[model samples]
Every structure is written in structure tokens, then in C-alpha cells.
Target chain A: MNAYWQCLRGIVLREWLRFVLQRTRFLSALVRPLLWLVVFAAGFRAALGISVIEPYDTYIPYEVYIIPGLACMILLFNGMQGSLAMVYDREMGSMRVLLTSPLPRTFLLCSKLLATALISLLQVYGFLAIAWVYGVQPPAMGLLLALPALLLVALMLSALGLLLSNGIRQLENFAGVMNFVIFPLFFLSSALYPLWKMRDASQWLYWLCAVNPFTHAVELVRFALYERLAGLALAICLGLTVLFTLLAVLTFNPQHAALRKPG
Target chain B: MNALTVQDLSFAYGPCQALCEVGFSLAPGRFAALLGPNGAGKSTLIALLTRLYHLQRGEIHVGGHSLRDAPRAALKQLGVVFQQSTLDLELSVEQNLRYHAALHGLSRRHTDLRVEAELARQGLSERRREKVRALNGGHRRRVEIARALLHEPRLLLLDEASVGLDPASRLGLNQHVRQLCREHDLSVLWTTHLLDEVHADDALMILHQGRLVASGQVDALVQEHDGDLGRLFAGLTRPTATGAPA
Candidate 1:
């Protein structure tokens, strides 16, 4: 019990230290979403009219409306980037240090997932902090309320990212896969445009947005940031997080033949 | 009791067999050297021993715990230094050791004491705060050794751990590990293709193409195979599929 706690603490601490050491990662993480908030949102502010949504009491600016989605975007990119690092670790032999732990592989992998998720959350909050100064303030209480919701989405995306990266045979292909997964998950979901806008664009596209777990993740954060509850979104995020974690743990073995993670 | 044991062990990567019917045991305090050429499945065997790859057939027991049936317990009693360096170059030596200790579930007090002790033992206490990337290859390997020993496993396995070291560093590392084995009563299975690393009295196992071709005391095997270590190794591990011409 105490061992589990220590292990988790250590894993998180290592990740935090690494995150600190790599200043460029944090900077890029912020720069991506802030680009959307400052530039993309300004460009779309007049073009896309956001109606009264459940979390928003009145009409909201594009910048205000897309904050949750962009927050989730940070998670999405971090999740994939974390997976790429996992593959890199495997090849470079650092992963041997991890798998050799006497702890159950499942527990170790989860510790890693939680560690990456926490680090991603730091970047998300950083983005939110900048957004607050950018005149896109939610309630102070709502900001506090969004932490747990954002954490769930982070875990879900990290787990899903790990599961997806397991199939990647070469590290060189990681960028391609990242662009492939990130673009679809970002654009097809309610991250940029609202679901109503998607429906207006195409019925099938709207269905894809509705069913995409990222949409529910975005909605969950969107609601939590306003001190409300999206029950269905919460349920979906919780369920998918568990599912992705289990699937990731199950398929986590190093492939003996291809050494998918290594050369 | 034997510190480590394997029986009828076999593994395959698709159609290519990595190990076959290979069985051996390490006595509680002996230093055993495993010799194999590049294509000789040494890495595969090490991967299986460290639980990096799942077993397709056979059994492995580490300090009486079956690796397949009880991996956690089995791993708890085993420590390994892989062929490739596993330390995070970005982390300080002390930080790397702490991470390993935590993975093994050591308490804070235990971790501090163990880290200090192992670093001192490895002559690395002064470099605890130095990032691993700043250290030379030999020093980094020592850090890995200290980390591997922190949990105090009964057996230590090194898979070609001295690959890139200079001749002096390689011999120094080898001698250091032997001294550690004697002082600590820890069993070791050191794998390498270098014949000079094998002492006449140490337990020796030469693997060839997934098979244990010869295993016994090096002196006795030397006596049996015409008193020449090089010829014995070459004769036994000829590239032919049949092996040894026996």
C-alpha cells in the first residue's frame, strides 16, 4: 500500500522533473492552444456565432466558447507526444528500467499514464491561466472545478494514445500517426466548431462528432468549467478512460519478433 | 537453494526459434558467465529472464518463485543490467537510483540509506548529483549496477553489460562485479561473447543458436575439450546447424 503510494509519487516526480527540464515542450504546448485562442478565435469570432449552450448562460465569443476544446487539445497533443516518448524510451533502453520493476506491469503502466496525465494537466492549467488574462475568464470557482474533469480527459487520451502507439513499428512513423490521430480527433469533434455547426455542414460529420469520445471529453470540460454537469459526457469519459486503460495494459507486452517499440 | 533456475525453456519469434530446451541453474553465490556469439539468442534469453518478453514454452524460477506463475515475486528476487544502458541521461545519478528504489517500493528512509550505501559502494557518491549524460560510459554503467542492486535481489543478471567500455574499464567492471559477488554472496549470470572474461574456475555456459552447447566449470571443460578454451568454444559453436559435430 505504502509502496504503491511511493511508486506513484516517484513516477510523477520524475515526469515533473523531465517536464521542467524540457522548457520547449511546455512552451510549444501553450503556444499551440494560444494560437487558436488569440489568432484563430479572433478570426472566427464574427464568422461563427455561438448560441446559448448548456454551460454558457448567454451568447459567448468564439474565444470563450472554444476554451474547453483547446484545453482538451493540449491533452490530446500531450497524450500522443507521451506515447511517442514511450516508444523512444523502449528503443533507447530506459523502458527496461521501468519494466524490470517488481511491481505488476499493469500498475507500472498506470503509474506512467497518471504521471504523463498530471504533467499534461499542468500545461492545460498554464494555458487556462494565460486565457484568463486574455479576457476569456470563466468563474474562479469554475476554473477550480474543471481540474478533475480535465484530469479524466487527460487520462482517457493518454491511455488511448498509448494503446494506439503500441502498433507503431517504427519511431519515424510516429509523426505521421500523430498527425493522423490528432487531426481527426480534433477536427471531427466539437473542439473547433459546435455540434450544431457540424450538423449544418454534414449529417454524417455531425454523427461522427457526437460519437467521438473527444467530443464528450470536450463537453465534460465545457460543463465543469461553468460549474454544471454533463452527465452523459461524464459517463462517457469515465467509461472510455477505464476501457482505454484496460486495453492499453493488456496489449503492453514488448513484441519479441518485431520489437515494435525498438529496432 | 539455487538462486535462479530454468527448465525446458523455449521461445520463438514467429518461425525463428530464439531459445530451445535450454536449462541451467545458478548456485546461491557463484558467478556464472554465459557466452554466446552475436546470433546466439543471448539477448532473447536475457529478455525472457527479465520478463521483457513472455515465454512461449518452459519454466523459470527466481529464488523459488516461478516467473510465469508469479512474476512479481520472481522479479522481486532478481536484478538485471541489460545490454543497452537503461539510465535516463537527463536525470542525476541519485535521481535515477531513487526512481529505481521507488519502483521496488522502498520507504523514504530505506531509499536514502540504500542510495547512499550503493553509491558509496560503487564509488559514485561524489557524482550523485551529476546528470547521467555528463558521466562517461563506465560511470553510467556503475550507476546502473548500483540501481540494480538497490533492492538487494539474490541474483544479478547482466546482458552484455560491458559492451562499449574500453579494455581497462571492461576488466575493471568485471573484477568489481566479482568482488561484489564474493562480499555480498549475491549470484550473478553475466552474458558476453568475450572469452577472456571467463575465468577457469567460474561456472561457464556457452550458448549456440538457441541451444546450451556446453555448460560446466570452465577448467573442467577446458580439460575435457583438449586444454584449449578457444578451440573448445570454436569446436562447440561452429556455425553449422547440427552443432559440435557430435
Candidate 2:
């Protein structure tokens, strides 16, 4: 309906306006991955082997090999940080304003999640543009094909962020999540190294990486950027995105949650 | 039908009861005030009325639409201004209003017109382009009031809206809201703990320890209970040494 469209447009516009005002967030997001790409990757090139995985026919250098993971890192950080802001919004009373809307709660939350995801795409593209200039270019057609994959990963991560934030009712409790959630999801996945390397390091570690949803997100982006489809990765990302979103919506109950904590 | 109706509403925070069998109604175009002490569950009632808290046991009807059975319709007929500022400080005054209008699903042209009309009505047309952070406490509250009126709901609820304002600003806000009620035929439920905020002719409900102890015309209730508001409020809300309500 036209109403839904207008609501979504408004939500996205608010996010875009906020993003513009806090341009430092964009720069902060870019700095971490760029350090990994331009500095860490350069230093570790001799240490890590570059192999031609499935969906790849030509040899890709270490710089190109890790591009998908770093792009997803931006999404990961943005998604978690976005949900953190939601918790802070609750304290500041903006979340109450959003909930008081005439629209269904599910619809409002979804619009917000999608809007955050869409705004994050700008940062992803910014990183990709820098990579393009740094000599990590994929095929032009492949670049076009990777757009939807990047968006899907962004949505999946954002949903996961929301779901995780449900258990964290207090703002002070969120710093622990950065260490307990972000570091595990980032380091245990195929972001820095492929799964085969993890398998070579340890079978149990390889299974851990294989099952992490972030691994599927990264693999899907990696394959899409090479004009190939990872059907299994596609299925896992889609399934997890739906699961995380449903769980997030179901658990986001501020009123029922108690304000007190036991000593 | 009354502009708003709440019947036998009860709620709890875990094992602690926040509201118990509370009930009230506001007639069309009447300005009603909800007065309660800090721990008297005013926030709980506001949360329930605004749907920030789900209904645990009671029924609320707004403009003839049931909040339980037809939430969207019920909510469409109501407007609210929370105690804390909900306007995005980084956004312009007009931008905040437009965001609220869009959330209510107004068309772009309709939103523009409504925004313009509300600014003029609040005498804030000159400050539309300024960021909310630039506005002083009173002007920011005016902007919030204008934003709440954008969709033209039949009932307006202000939950301790005059908190953190100068005494003069508080009086000005109260008078301005009364003028708005006259001009728009809008029913208002103003919740506060301040005794000076309630005029003699206003409809008054005094809540105490999770229960409403008195409700009626302010003058009549004051005459019936005690000679003065300070003594009457102290007698009603004071807890006994045994931790029981007076």
C-alpha cells in the first residue's frame, strides 16, 4: 500500500539524514577494514596462501581473496552498532515514539532494520571503491552481480544484531557483547582465512567455521563477486536471516521486561 | 461516546503491582489531569494507555475503537507527548514533524500542509528550519506538541510534559494547551505530580500507591476532602509506618 511505502521512505530518509550528520561514523567504519586490507594483508601475504576455491577459475591474489570478508566486516560492525543505538534510543525515549506509531510493531522494526542495512551499503561500496583503486578489481559484470549478495548479508547480520540485543536490556551490558559476540563471529569465521586452512589447523575448528552463519555470508559474497553461485551458502544465509528476524521481533518486549536487577 | 475510556486496568512489574483496578474516562473537549506522587504508578498508567506496555487485564477504548481489539484504529485516534524529549535533536524542527507524519502514513503533500499548519498554529513557523538542539526547553516542547497534533487525533495525552521547565514556562505550556483544547475541541489527559498545574474547574484524578484515591471536579473534590490541596495530597499519598498506604 502507499502508506507502507511512505512509512518506509520516511524511515530510510531519517537514517540517511542521521548518517550524513554523523559522517565520522562512516570514516570510523572504513578505517578498520582499510587497515586490514592495505596494511595487514600486505604484511600477511607471504604468510597466507592464496588458492583457487570453487566458483573461481583464475588465480586471485591475497588482496582480492579477503575483500569479501572485509566488506562483510563493515556490515557486522554496523549491524551490532545499529542495535546498540536502539538500546540507547530506548533510554532516550525515541524507541517509545517509534513504538507508538499506528503501524504494526513488526512492520516498524523491519523497516528500521532494512533502513539500517540500506545505509550500510554505502559504507560497503565506499570500501569496495577504495579496493578497486588499490588493485583488487573483480570482473565488471561480477561487481554488478555482487550487489544483491552484499545486501542479503547486510540484512542477515542486522537481524542477528537485533536478536542478540534483545537479551541486553541495559546500555551498560552492551560493551561485553562487542567482545563476546563480535570477536567470536569475526575471528572464528572465514573472514581472515578460508575453511580449508581452518581444517588444516584443526578439524574441530574447521567445523566451527563451517557452521558459523557469517562464514556462509562471506562465502556467498566471495562467490557472487566471481560470477558464481554457492547454492548452499545462499540457502543458509536466507534461512538465518528469516530466523533471526522472527526471533528479534518476538523477543523485543520492553514493557514486559523488568527494570530491576537482583543483587 | 467518551473521547477515552479505561476500565479496571491492572498491571505488574514482575512481582510488584504497578497499577491496580484503575479506571477513568474523558469527555469530548474536556481537559482532565492525572495527579499522583512519584511512586504512585503514573508512568505505568501512561505506558499502558500509549501501548508501550501491553494490556494485562483491562480494556481501553479511544474514540469508540477498542485498544485491544482494534489497536491501529484506536491508536490512530490518539496522540501522545512523552515526559522526556523524543524529538531528534540533530534533526530540524520541520524534519521531526515530517518524520512523525510519515510514520502515520500521511501523503507527501498532506504532510507538507499539515507541517506548515502546525508550525503556524504553534507560532513556530520561523524556527522550522532550525535543529531541535538549537531550540530552548519551551520551544522544543512546543515543537513536540505541534508534532503530536499533525495527525489530528481526538485525544492528547501528555505524561509529565512540563518537567524540567521553568515555573513560568510550565504555566505558559499549561495555558497554551488549554487554549488548544478550546480551539480544536480536543480532549486532553495531562499527567503530573504538581498541585499548581490543576485549575479548580479541571477534572482531577489523584492516584496513590497504585490505586486512584480521588477523582472528580477539582474544586468539589478539594472541598469534600480537605480545606487545602497540600494537606489533602499528603493525607492521601502518605504511607503508614507499617508500609501500608494511608
Candidate 3:
């Protein structure tokens, strides 16, 4: 019993404490979405128009359309940021200490991912509260429904981040990942604009948005804000979470070259 | 029972071999030193012993548990201080130890008591609350040593842990580790490039170019070379004109 709680307590506290130690990291997580909410959304409000979507009964402002995206942006960056911390820990040798423990490596890694997901959830709520101050408020009951959706998105994103961290060899290579993964993932999804708007530009972009797992993630949050359920979003997000988590575990397997320290 | 054993352990990186046909074993409570120069594969061997890498050819066992078949159990019986500092500089000494203890699943009540006992055992109680960044190099090493012992492992492996320390600190650390082996009946495998660090009774293995050329008690090996361990080490490791197959 002590062992079970310790595993949960240890990794959770360690991950949270690491983020707390760097207050700037948390601020940056909040600030990035805030920038999108304030400057980018303000500038692009007129350029992009919105039709009444399924989740929105009446016509809604563009600021409201992108709020879900900004919430997702927080989860995306913060989740990957946690993975980056793992790489730093590996290079600094503290990862070796953690890896040598008696606990199964899978459990240890999962514990970390769960902690990261929880932190991402907190950041999403913080961003939502800030967005409310800007006159973009979800139904008060909608906020309650958003919790489970936010958790699912965070889990999926954090798993993807862990998988990438396990594969990347050097710190220098991580920048390329941000551009290839975060940039494309955020841009190709329904984060910035709805899929129908992308179809107006190109069928290919719309198809990309249709297949993107992130599209489902944003859709999940968007509908939750209006007290609606996204069955497709739930399936896609949960499926991707399991897929990415399996990849992470395989990559960290003792047989893998990248996971091992050179003798 | 042997505390640790390795049989024909071999590994390679792409085309370059890192370890080839390496083998050794240490009895319970014995102290052994793996002596080699830079790029001689001493660090590589330590990595293998710690199960940081899986070998293509060979077997490693700790207290009778196979590394390949039971890594978590094997690792639980072994402790390691790597060549690089593993301490979290942003955390205090006690925080670092507590984090490790929790990972090993020690209860909060036990972790506190064990942390105090370990700090006292490592002669670090006075500095327990100090941030790791504030500690000097030697003190940081001490923190790592105390951390490796927090779980009370039967085998301890140190990879070039004394490098860059002042002479007095190095001697102090060596003495302290040797004392731990005696007091706790822990088997120790210490890797170092410095010949002076090898004691007369300690078993020594000379490795060069990924091959083990010599293994025996230091005093016996020195006697075989007429009381010249350095010359023997060089002659065995230096490439000969014939370049005989290792």
C-alpha cells in the first residue's frame, strides 16, 4: 500500500515541484495563450468570419471560436515542455537515478505523464478564467463539463510528448521538433479556424484537418464549452493517448539504443 | 555468494566496439578496481553493470538475478554513482534524497528517518538543507554517495567518481567508501584512471581498446612485474609491434 501511494506521490510531486521551481515556465505557458487571445485574435477577428457551428446555437464572435484553441495551445506546449525537462534530466544524470528504482519503468513513466496532464489541466482553467475577463465566457455549467475533456486532451498531448522525448537523441534536435510537431499540429487543426473555413481555401487542408488528432482535441474542448458531447473527439483522443503511450514505452525499452547511456 | 558477475559481456556502437569479451566477478564484501585510461571502456563497463545498456552478447547477474530477465529486481540490489554528477543542483541535498527515496517507494515516515540516518552516515547531516548548487564538487559527490546508499543496496558501483577532486578529498572519499564496504558487507567496484587509488589487496582489472588484458590482486600483479604496477599496466595496454589479437 505504501509502495502504491509512494509511486503516485513521488512522481506527481517531483513533476509539480520541478515546474514550480521554474515559475517562469508556468507564466510562459499562460502568456503564450494569452498572446493568442489578445493580440492575434484581435488582429484576425475581422479577417476571419464564423458561421453558427454545431456547438454554438447562435452566432458567436471569433474571439470565442479561438478560445478553445488557446486552451489547447496551453496543453500542447506544457505537455511537450515536460518532456523537454525529461531530456534535461537525462543529460544531467538525474534520470539515471530515477530509472534505477525498483518500480517498473512503465509505471514510473506513466506517473510522470499523469502529473504533466494534471498540470496542463490547471493551466487550461487558468487561461479560461483569464479569457472570461476579456468578455469571452462559456456557460457556467459548460465549465464543469470541460474538465473531463481537458484531462483527455492533456493525456493525449503529454503521451505524444513523452514518445518524442524518448526518440530524440540530442537537445539541439528539439527545436526542429517544435517547428515540425507543435507548429504543424497547431496550424493544421481546427485551432485557428474551423474546418469549413479551411475547405474554402483548399480541400487538402480540410482533409488534413479532418484526420488530425488535434482537430478532435480542439473539437472536444469547443463542444464542452457549450455543454455538448463529442463522441468522435472522445474516441480519437483516447485512441491517440493509448497509441502514443505504447510508442513511448517501446522507445524506452532497455533494448533501444537511444534510451541507454553509452557504456 | 558473488555480489556481481559478468560473463563474456560484449557491446558495440555501430561499427566501433565498446566492450568485447569482458568478464569479471567480485565476492561479497570485496573491493575491486577497474583501472584503465581514457577511452579504455571502463565507463562502458560500468554502464553495463548498471544495466543502462543491453548487451548483444553476454550475461550480467546481481545476487543471482539475471539482468536480462529481471532488470528491476537486479537493479534493486545494485547502487551506482555515475561518472557525471547526478544530483539536482536546483534542489537541496535532503530534497534530492527524498525524491530518490520516494521513487524507490519508501514511505514518508521511513524516508524521513532514512534520510537523517543516511546524511549522518555520509557525514553530511550538517549540510542537509543546503542547496546542491551551493555545495562544492566533493560535497556534491558525497550527496550522490549518500543517495546510492539510501536503499541499502548490496553492490555499489562508482565510475570515475573521484576525478577532479582535491587530493585530500579524494583520499577522504576513498577511505569512507572502503569503510562502508567493511561495515555493511557491501561489494564495491570502483573505476579510476589513477594508479595510486588502487590498493594492495584490491582486485584490479586492466582494460584497453575494449578488451581485458589482466585481472588479479594488485599486489600479485605488481609482484609479477617486479613491484611495478604502472609499467605492467602500460606494457599490457600499449599496442605491441606484433599487435597480438586481444
Most accurate candidate by lDDT? 1
**Individual DockQ of the candidates?**
0.63, 0.58, 0.57
Where does candidate 1 stray beyond 4 Å?
A: A256-263, B241-246
**Angstrom error at residue B121, model 2:** 1.2
Pairs that clash in candidate 3: A263-B44
Instruction: Let me know the DockQ for model 2.
Output: 0.58
lDDT of 3 at A58: 83
Q: What share of the true interface contacts does each candidate keep?
A: 0.69, 0.63, 0.66
TM-score of 2: 0.97
Model 1 docking category:
medium
Per-residue CA lDDT of model 3 for A1-263, tens digit only, reads: 67857968877887777778888887888999899889998898888878888899888788999999889989999878877877777766677777777787888888888999998887889889999999999999999999999998998999999898887776777897799899989999999998998998999989998998889999999999889999989888989999999899877754342234454
lDDT (CA) for every model shown?
0.90, 0.89, 0.86
Candidate 2 residue-wise lDDT, B133-218, digit = tens: 99999999999999999999999999899999999999999999999998899999999999999888899888887888888988
What is the two-chain DockQ of model 3? 0.57
TM-score of chain A of each: 0.96, 0.96, 0.95
Per-residue CA lDDT of model 1 for A1-263, tens digit only, reads 99899898999999998999999999999999999999999999889999997878899889999999999999999999988888888778787788888888789889999999999999999999999999999999999999999999999999998997777666788988766889999999998989998899899999989999999999999999999989999999999999999999888766522233221
Per-residue CA lDDT of model 1 for B44-70, tens digit only, reads 888888888888899999999999999
Predicted structure 1, TM vs. truth: 0.97
Question: Which residue pairs overlap in candidate 1's backbone?
Answer: none
